[model samples]
Target chain A: MSVLTQIKQAPAANPIERLLLATEADMAKVNALILSRADSHVEMVPELARYLIESGGKRLRPMLTVAAAQLFANGTGTAVNFAAAVEFMHNATLLHDDVVDESDMRRGKPAARMVWGNKASILVGDFLLGQAFMMMVETGNIGALGVLSSASAVMAEGEVFQLAKTGDLTTTAADYAEVIRAKTAVLFQAACEVGAMSGGADDAGRKALAQYGLELGNAFQLVDDVLDYGGQSGTLGKNVGDDLREGKMTLPVILALAEASSEDRETITAALGDAEATADQVAAVVAIMERHNTLARTMEQAQAHARSAKAALEALPGSEMRSLLSEVVEFSVVRAY
Target chain B: MSVLTQIKQAPAANPIERLLLATEADMAKVNALILSRADSHVEMVPELARYLIESGGKRLRPMLTVAAAQLFANGTGTAVNFAAAVEFMHNATLLHDDVVDESDMRRGKPAARMVWGNKASILVGDFLLGQAFMMMVETGNIGALGVLSSASAVMAEGEVFQLAKTGDLTTTAADYAEVIRAKTAVLFQAACEVGAMSGGADDAGRKALAQYGLELGNAFQLVDDVLDYGGQSGTLGKNVGDDLREGKMTLPVILALAEASSEDRETITAALGDAEATADQVAAVVAIMERHNTLARTMEQAQAHARSAKAALEALPGSEMRSLLSEVVEFSVVRAY
Candidate 1:
């Protein structure tokens, strides 16, 4: 049987995992490029950089870039470069985020900052970002470069906005939407947009990919945020209620706060930003979210984004890659189930 | 008298100050661009960014970019954008550096971290860097973008290397050279090279400007290092002996360590990395540096680089700007006197 026929017959495998298998060949090249680019004559740079990059998170962002590129067969090998650049940008942000959040663990391992110290993390993060831009410049595509650079600026702005809103009960759901869009969705939009551009996709294909990626990124983050309060630590690779402890105003909390009674609101506000909050406090906060049906509503919101993500794919001609990307968005939101 | 003759006849005006005056009209546009680009809907970003960018330092790096571009009369107006980008890059580094060093003062003011906090400083620094790259992308000069991006990587590497060498008495002079070159000289080289490119410089003119900027940057940093030990706190915009307390292995310190008696070596090492080192300890270290004439040797080294910087100008056709650039190199080192 042909590979497509066999893929169709594969009944039980998750779409994301299947998509990963489908794009594994191109992704290997991106992975190799990432490893080579992360290297430096300075020993600590590569050492600290690999410590985070090699950590076994799903390489979802780069995979999206690769998969989006593969939606068209006109690849000129620029997608490999863009995929690697996207990964570098993501890793750089992780390094800085750990320092900013004082995170002790990532991907079920000691965070890079925890191992290398905050100073090394900060400088090495800068190094990775510089390398990301270098790879983008090598592509000689000015339009793609403009897209990526704007995403970069918006991501920083999103991060700053999130920092500004931390622990503020007055933060609106609109503000939360803006935060997730800036912090997470913008890069997704840029990645898929540039991927399609590299794949020789015309304007319609690129716009479709961009909209699809943005909605998928929104769904991905909302599910991840819900998981922070409800998923297992082993599955999440982080402690439960980390967002609450860090005072991150995620959607479920925002929704819960808006609907909760004064007593329940007091329960959350007390635990918010309190690093010393006990397990019982976290349980109480989760219970309030449950009482308000916020987690379920958050999952519904994520599902809505996932549906939009799939809807955006209508702009592109039907292909197995496109169908698989559509299913991946469903799989992302369904995880909260 | 003509403007060139008038400039030559001007009595004892600092060449850097004179260059700034010469480029005032163009630089005003660059300054305005910097302010406008730094703005954001996220208010803290613009606030913290301006707090650093508007802080009155020499604006020396941007001035070099503008003057180098002015060497060719065929300016395309891109130099204004490049100049602003260079300033943003410089200011971004300063924000992150202050956080990494836990510094208390910058430009004779409390460091941004002290006023705004490290998290804000870090995120705002990222914002400025993003803005810097955006401005570069707007220029649509991929080659110049490559130059700036590579310099950014090298600067981060230099900072990491410096961190590695901190308090290591065994650090060689070659290592010190590598650190300062990466940290300081590369940006200067890139600034002038891109400026010349924007100004429509020929290959020889670009190469000459790059060499001149590199050597002048070497001389400038050497003088700055010497001043850290010998200049007043009011003049240096930082406490005297701050480098010693931080255990920086600068040129004079390296030289002094090499030639000191064992007793004097003990005094220097004891004070190294001792954040609370007494004024008497700093004086003793300086006294040893004087006994070994290390400060004088460092000044001699600066003078040598300054001369090489001037010699590099021989490749370019002589113009008032070229003459003023050569004089700026001399004036950089003369500050030591």
Candidate 2:
């Protein structure tokens, strides 16, 4: 049977095991390529890069690159290169975003900007972004370069959109989704879709994989917003109510604020919209979220996205890899970390 | 005659003319390709993007891309695309640099950061950089992509190197040159060489054009640094003494300090190194520069680079375009604005 036929058959019984074997298995090789493990500022940029990658965060994007390539051809090394490229782009965004937000912490550690000054952080981000394009060129895969460039453009647009909305309290769920998709899901989709392009997935297969990844990314972000609202509670590296404190209007808060009574809306807005919001005020906003059932509603929306993401994979030939991808949808909403 | 032969033999009074024509003629088409040129924040980003293209800052780098392509083969219209790509990259860096330096004016107007907040300035700079790569891919020129990507890596590395030396009084001319190459010259070299590549220039022609651009760029930035030390006397858009106030270690000061006696050196260091150097103190440091003839010395260096740049262009046969390129070497050291 063809490689495409092979990737499509038999969803795996154990999702995490497949995720580990398919994605994380090549970490050593990627580390060697980055030569970042031995860097002095490893704690600064390189560490942050690794933390974002290895902090048990899903490697779905890179896996998509791997799987996409596999659909057309098979090479352990080629797959690893594409995977690393996706991750490099992802980390670059995180670095810049932290500076843009004046964020002091990310994934529960002082952010790169906070630990290193903004200049170092910003320049390092640029360096990594440059390095990512270099890697794509090294691939000599024009198609892959196209995919990465498009994804990066979407990411930058998302960032600009987010900047446009900063401190504005009227952001809608649709607008929020637009931001998330531009900033987050576009890269995810591009990651998976590019895999197909690189791997030799036919148009139909590439389209399917891209759709699956985009939906999955949306689901992942939606749940991430939910968790920020006090859902799973004890995830290490998780900062509770950060979006609220930053006055960022995420999906849950937007929905909740719309549904809230005038008085509660006033209170929530008063607390969250202020950049100088106190912890007590932040806690009070969460209480209002509970009263308005915004958190529950957000979870419902998350589940719906998760279901759609899984459904995208259903038509693909069921392989252990596909099953693991399906399990990623569950993990998106289920895991605390 | 073939494109290479044509480039070699054509005699134009101004070397920059052909490049200027390529970019200037393409402006309408370039403007059309940009999204949301009339959006509310268009004044912020799209407007800046347009201002950048229209502002008539030396189109030297873009010209290099064009010249490089023409040297290699028939450029078709791909040279135009690569030209736009390099310009976008150059403009993005300029926007960000102004912000990082807290520079108040550029091209004779308030810098983008001064008009917009630092946050907006930075994000918009990022948007343009992303747009540049997008433009590159749209050109369907993978070689151009490789050239520009490597240039960006060098550009970023140069920025990091400069950041490392900021406020340090002991930086050498060699150290400064390394920074200038990374920060300013690589893109210039890439621009010319990429043009040659697009034009299907043979390897030797491509190499020659790259060297020409490198020397030309080095010449341009050296004069720029001299201008920072009152090289222009009065025609610059912004105040001349600002760099010293910001503790920026430019060439004039580097040379001046190197020759200062211990007492003068100590005074210069103490005055310039202060986070809040008084205007008088800044002026005092300028006086030290005058006493040491550092500015004149730096100007001599700039003139030497101009000669070198002109020499490099001689490798190409005499053409009107080549002559114009040579004129740019003179203009780099002599332009009033």
CA lDDT, candidate 2, residue A79: 55
B1-337 per-residue lDDT for model 2 (tens digits)? 4333444454562445544553444444444544332122323556555654555466556656655554434853677777777877887788777766777778787776766667776666677777778778877777778889988877876877787788876688888988888888898888888888777777777787888778877877777776765645555677766677677778888988898889888777886646577767767777888898887777787788788878877777776556666766787677634
Residue range B72-174, candidate 1, lDDT tens digits? 8676379888889999889989999999988999989999999989988888888888889999999998988999999988999999999889999999899
Off by over 4 Å in 1: A1-11, B1-12
State each candidate's clash count: 0, 41
Query: lDDT of all the models against the reference?
Result: 0.88, 0.70
Q: What is the DockQ (computed on Cα atoms) for candidate 1?
A: 0.82
DockQ per model, Cα: 0.82, 0.45
Q: What is the RMSD, in Å, between candidate 2 and the native fold over all Cα?
A: 4.3
Candidate 2, after superposition: displacement of residue A256 in Å? 1.5
lDDT of 1 by residue, A196-289 (tens): 9999898889999999989999998899999999775576788888899999999989999998989989999999999888889999999999
Best by lDDT: 1
- Once model 1 is optimally superposed onto the true structure by TM-score, how far is the C-alpha of residue A141 displaced, in angstroms? 0.6
TM-score of each model, paired residue for residue: 0.97, 0.89
Evaluated at residue A241, the lDDT of candidate 1 is 87
